[model samples]
Target: MLNDFSPAAAASSFSPAFSPPEVSQPAPPTFTSPAAAVAAAARLAPRLFEQAARTDEVGGFPTQEFAWLRETGLLTAALAPALGGAGLGEPAAALALLQVLYHVGRGNLAVGRLFEGHVNALLLIQRFGKPAQVAAYAADARAGHLFGVWNTENPAHGVRLNFLAGGTYRLHGAKTFASGAGHITRPLLTGALPAHHGWQMLVLPADEQPPQLDRSFWRPLGMRATASFIASLERLEISADCLLGQPNDYYQQPWFGGGAA
Candidate 1:
């Protein structure tokens, strides 16, 4: 079982040096079309596979593999050029994105899961987030920050987004089956607001504090490298800028409620 701890206690356990360093911006690559993006993924296949085998055996985080992804610029290939990505222009952008994911999945399912979430986070920011939010996250991706989404909640202690007096918010409760629990830089999660009104989506730095992890919660024999864990987030302060879409936006129709799923 994952024991909950106060924010202060969690803060005390972490060293400042554990925080990820700020990454410098790298020059964006130019991709004329979807085919170009596919080719790049093809070139990276061997390396991704080589690392995947080791990660699966170890059953921990794939840190070194992630670094390789960052260095190769394959992590941000799905974003638009303006966002410092390899410009995989549309009409075939969706197909191109799928191709990249397929190749990555072939190499390693766990890393592929993380990469897929990263792409989803970028797409969410592109579609619903404010201009500034989009730019900030895009810059982070360009700087090699990995993103993920964690929506699973514990029924006994569902996650809540409580509005604070200072115009900020604090998270309470835990998310279960959270993949890349410790390694993901920016993780997008959903929680219910007060009064049972609606849900809200927010992004926060996963490594800011040492989140209590129930490592044993994940016992799958396959994709063990994912490092999925139960995360207890009790009284975790959240900045105003971290809020992504509006309340209940996560369940909106046509996109989520409709056939798009």
Candidate 2:
């Protein structure tokens, strides 16, 4: 858990130098099938295991591991097949994704945990985002941009969204246990809307400055590389399009039911 919604004073900050994400990565490989994607992940697992020892410290991240994932194209494998991916999340192909996760986790849980977030965020956008939204993010994935989901928040002061003028929503409060805090360029965040409006799901803009990270809140017994930290996005304003689906749509079918199944 990310601790409480009440702000924690002890924290540290990490900002990815590559944001607005000008990552220099190779083009993704063409995946022939979900089976091929699984094979690729299986093969890469041990290599990540070898690196796990390196990223096991406080604030460690599987940077090289993810770069390798980008090079191999598993980063984009969850997209629809028509998008030059393996369609890993569809019912017929979902098992392949699970197998990949199993292997990665067997090798290193931190990397597996982060990779799962990347895959699940893509699935959520593909399932709930509009066509233009989907196309734009797919392009980012192909370009090696990592994604994450941040839903946990402070219990006493969970993140909130205040609708504002000109199709904007101002953020309030913080999200705790926010994984990939500084590393992920795109994070799908959940914030409470006005009482009658339910919750809102929104993806922060890729270029938005990194949210404030309180380093003190992150001292897990393990998976420290996951960088699950307290993030306060209070007062950040986002355009309407950043909103993913209707109020409370994040809890809907498929994903809410656990898309991995």
Candidate 3:
């Protein structure tokens, strides 16, 4: 059965450990309707296409394309209306996201993939994160933080999180094929936990503690602009706030299988 990922379901599953965000979010841009959101992306298609060819090099990223996306406010459009977005990822506007992805892919597939990852990351947070985590990440989206989801890793050197005292974690290992490596500031990463705790999802601020980026690890036949690289996060210390949801929430039910679909 499909997961009941509605707002009510999300709140019902929240843990007592998490509290709502104290800082009130500033008023977001007047809610962009789904049509308007898609239209804005459509307007930028040609420009994205024009730049795609130039960025097809090793470690290349669509920086200008993302700038235009931020300028057009598409980055935050995945959030719900209450959070100052167009509700693109909500159940009601599901088709709108597909249409937006289609248009974006028509121009540049790599950008489309990265955009999908961004939207999916936000969607997951809304569905699985605590109220505070959701609100904070939504604010980041509105503030033009480029978000990404990094899950893949080498089998032998996979990302691992060692629990420490006082809700802190000591990370060891790295993530491979991490898209938009250097450019993605807020990356939602998954790491294996010790003592059979399953995997944990973390909202990493790569900009603050930059990972060891190895571009040589990514040798794609095409879509070179993805900039997927190996990012070693060895010894990175993170607080409890970085945790997105409970342990193993990432692979839970329809949310996990459904996301893959």
Candidate 4:
């Protein structure tokens, strides 16, 4: 049976200990429906394709196309209206998200992957984050900030979270196969808790301090523009509010397996 871990339940379990830094909000979304968003994506596809060859040849991050995506308001469409988004409500959200991904995927798989991660991060926040957290992240998203989910772990140096004084946490070690490494503004990462079993999920500024990226690690023949790299988060301090849910929440039985499916 799938475990029902609702946002309200998650919020009730933890109290906010800090607030995210303020961010200026962007202009209102230009498109509201999936069809309109997809249409806009279609209009941008050719330009993205034009840069695909170079982006692949460079074998690094895809920067130019993302600017177009942000300008078109495709990145913030999935967010709820209360959070400064286009308000593409349910029964249609899945289809809308699918269409957006499909159109972008047609232009470049690497960019599509990054965009998919961004959407996943936003959904996780929407599902488990408190109201303040949601609003803050929404504003960041609206302002063209990119989000990513980096869960892959390194066997040699497993990611760990150390509890600090005053209810804060510090992240040590690194995560491998982290996509959009340098470019992802806020990334949802997983770390094992010190002296505690299971993992914790956290959202932090990926580039707040320079992350150690092993550029030599990714040499894929395809999806070269993804910039998937090894990021060392040694001694990265995380405020209490950045922690989502509770210990073991990340791998919580049916939710991790079933909900993801």
Error at 165, model 4, angstroms: 1.3
Q: Write the per-residue lDDT of candidate 2 for residues 36-146, one digit (tens) a residue.
A: 999999999889888888988886788888878877888899999887689997889878989988988888899888888888899999989999999988888888778
- How does residue 93 of candidate 2 score in lDDT? 88
lDDT of 1: 0.71
- Please list the C-alpha lDDT of all candidates, in the order they appear: 0.71, 0.81, 0.76, 0.71
For candidate 3, the per-residue lDDT at 148 reads: 85
- Order by lDDT, highest first: 2, 3, 4, 1
Model 1, runs deviating above 4 Å:
1-30, 57-59, 87-91, 253-261
Using Cα atoms with residue i matched to residue i, what is each candidate's TM-score against the true structure?
0.85, 0.92, 0.85, 0.83
Off by over 4 Å in 4: 1-28, 87-91, 252-261
Ranking 1 against 2 by lDDT, winner = 2
Report the lDDT tens digits of candidate 4 across residue range 1-261: 002212122211111112222445446456756678778878887887778877884445677777778778877876876665555434456676677788888888888888888877887788778888988888788777788888887555768888889998877777778888767778888889877667888898754644566655677876767878677777778788888777777676644653354
Evaluate model 1: give its TM-score.
Answer: 0.85
- Residue 75 lDDT in model 1? 69
Clashing pairs in 3: none
Whose TM-score is greatest here?
A: 2
Q: Kindly report which residue stretches of model 2 are placed more than 4 angstroms away from their true locations once superposed.
A: 1-14, 17-25, 259-261
